[model samples]
Target chain A: MTAHASPIGPGPTGPGPTAPPPAPPAVSPLRLVATLGISGALAGLLLVSVHRVTEPVIAAHKQRVLEDAVLEVLAGPTSYRTLYLVDGAFTPDLPAGADPRTLDTVYAGLGDDGARLDGFAIPASKPGFQDKVSLLFGWEPKDGTVRAIRVLESRETPGLGDRIEKDPAFAAGFVGRTTPLVGVKAGRGTGAPSEVDMITGATISSRTVIDAIDTTLARLRPALDAYAAEAAR
Target chain B: MKETTAREDLLRGIWRENPVLVQMLGLCPTLAVTNSVANSLAMGIATAFVLLGSSVLVASVKRLVPGEVRISAYVLIIATFVTVADMALEALAPGIHKALGAFIALIVVNCIILGRQEAFASKRPVGRAALDALGTGAGFVIALVLMGSVREVLGSGSFLGHPLFGAHYEPWVVMILPPGGFLTLGSILIALSWLRRRRAAAAGEARS
Candidate 1:
């Protein structure tokens, strides 16, 4: 192998022209088995130790991020009450009022001390270019004006569609808008009372954000009216 | 214990054995995190730190790793270093830690680290293995940074969040999307192939 490698017409430079390196002497199977056993045990030990130490911190950060998003939607004076949606109509849960798991959602924000501040709808689904546009929306108690829109997850193309998640201007539009499938007009900003600016070159993205808001708002308004009527009575 | 050839361990990883452009290892970070020079730099250094730690530990214990279960054992070792990296990043730079998201934990699957231990580190002296790991890590960083800078400049009209081109330069919206990553990487590969052919032709002329 050494003699063959020495010179093969000026020695191979490219991978196609080059020769494989000389093979090293082989060892016995028993030795290989012992080596594997020891390494496996040691590596497993180190991994578990590290995971135990870091799990808390990782979990805390994740929790904090979610809390912050929820709170942002529930802004102003607030309290979070767990509600059971028994049959998809803001109803309560399983085990007979044991905080229904099958269809329960977190109804957030009363007042400084259980006073009525506002109500929010947590609408989560995969849509748009990347298939994960999770959002939290706060609608005012009456008229369903949008108070805020919080993006939880999205994988849209940066600059174009990602503007939905990152651009303050695009998000600022979501605030103060009243609902029903109305995407902000292309190019120039729409001068309507409930309108936001569409991204300059992302028509598909603009439509997605509008559709998400529209769908969420459509379901929310009727339920919100029912809740309002319940409160009045 | 017998030692492996240093030249084989070194040059193999740099080109024909590259961890990113050639080997196509660790595509998640290669695409998601490489959006800017700053992001790429942060990811690169984090990766290099983990590679160094894991290579040392894996090589030291190579004699004991069972051949039948080496793959599982290698993942265990790699995961530990990745956790250490995650912890350090969280403590020192919480901002970057959030920005990186699951990519930090995803490093557990990064083929560069495991590929080194399985192919080179476990079979070689500790020092030579470290050098090979460093070379491969460094090459990956360079490729990531290059890819990120190209996208940031063309897509967002910024460089590390700073403006390089004036407002007159219209942003190429497609450059920051998923397709943009593939686009830039493809063109770069073509350019690299072209350069190699030009260099090879030059060499042949001199020889003749």
Candidate 2:
């Protein structure tokens, strides 16, 4: 009968060896450990490489957003010329044609001459009721004005204090206002033609915007003057 | 492990061998990136890429790894793939990358990667391990996208950048906050459980 069963496990009648004997329950501990360690090292290297590659693209995107804001604030047929830090030694590197007027706060995109493009304004941040509030303002040296204002960052309450951001009439009030903007009540005539209307419930936020402008001008005026003087020469 | 039947291997991640909703693994990335659709999608892609890459490499070298120090070995392999995803994000789309912040780096701790290595990849053939990783990763991506869409729509009135609702929507701003993240997840889990129970009852009726 050709034995009818293979011999290897528990002999012919007990259990068939042809069944593969459960493959001896191979544990293979050494193989598992080594594979894991080597695989981990490779993955680490891959993560580092990808992070390095994406950093610049992200920065430029923010710059683009800022540039869009700057255009709303600057005046005349002007274009962004260049920036020079009053304190930084790199001021010497200011481009030859750069008007050197703007570039107080950053995130503004640079124009052809390496100056901040005319359309974008400086982005500034300051402490507000709960957290930091950031704003963008157009710095138009032509009339020595801050053309417009927009809130870029805030963490105030949504319906209450956040009304500062919620109310467009409040933001629209700041447009075309000259430097050193004075803020006041919205109705009954208190502002210069360029004066901004205050947010009814969020006086603190309104004040923060006014102060950021004050602070920006405190530092930005000198830089603007230098550029204006050069433009005249 | 014995070479799994094709159907069984594919079904593992759904329930009996789930990496997240069932096993409660990978909670850190799960919570941190579920705030918005963009964030969740980015995280899901990075993880899937890492899982796929590492699983294949581990399975290919299964015979070479020593048994004594496998855990350390597995971590090193996973970290390498994560680095690749990070650099790509940093270089190509830095805004999204910056928005995601440290959570991308934290993908290294995600239990999904290590679990696959220990439970399936180490024992399986290279091809099987890679496919298994892909399936599990796709499942994870689906979960993240679902979670992020709910949060973004409820939290911001925006779904993948479109105004899904009109201006009157209140946008439950809390949906974007940390507490909202926890609350949304709890509700999602409850909904998932109700679905499972209904499905089970239907199946039992059919059997009877």
Highest TM-score against the true fold, candidate: 1
lDDT of 1 by residue, A146-222 (tens): 77777767877765788788887777777877765366565465577666678877777767877777776565556
Tens-place lDDT digits, model 2, residues B1-115 = 2456656666666555455565556666777778789989999989989889889988887666665555666677777777777777776667678778788888887877876
Off by over 4 Å in 2: A1-120, A128-131, A141-144, A149-171, A182-189, A199-207, A219-233, B1-3, B64-73, B90-99, B165-167, B194-208
B116-162 per-residue lDDT for model 1 (tens digits): 67666676668877878777888778878888899989987898889
Model 1 spans with C-alpha error above 4 angstroms: A1-49, A78-104, A114-117, A184-201, A217-233, B1-18, B21-32, B83-109
Give the best candidate by lDDT.
1
Model 1 chain A: which ten-residue window has the lowest total lDDT?
A1-10
Q: Provide per-model DockQ scores.
A: 0.27, 0.33
Native-interface RMSD of candidate 2: 16.6
Candidate 1: deviation at residue B171, Å? Answer: 2.3
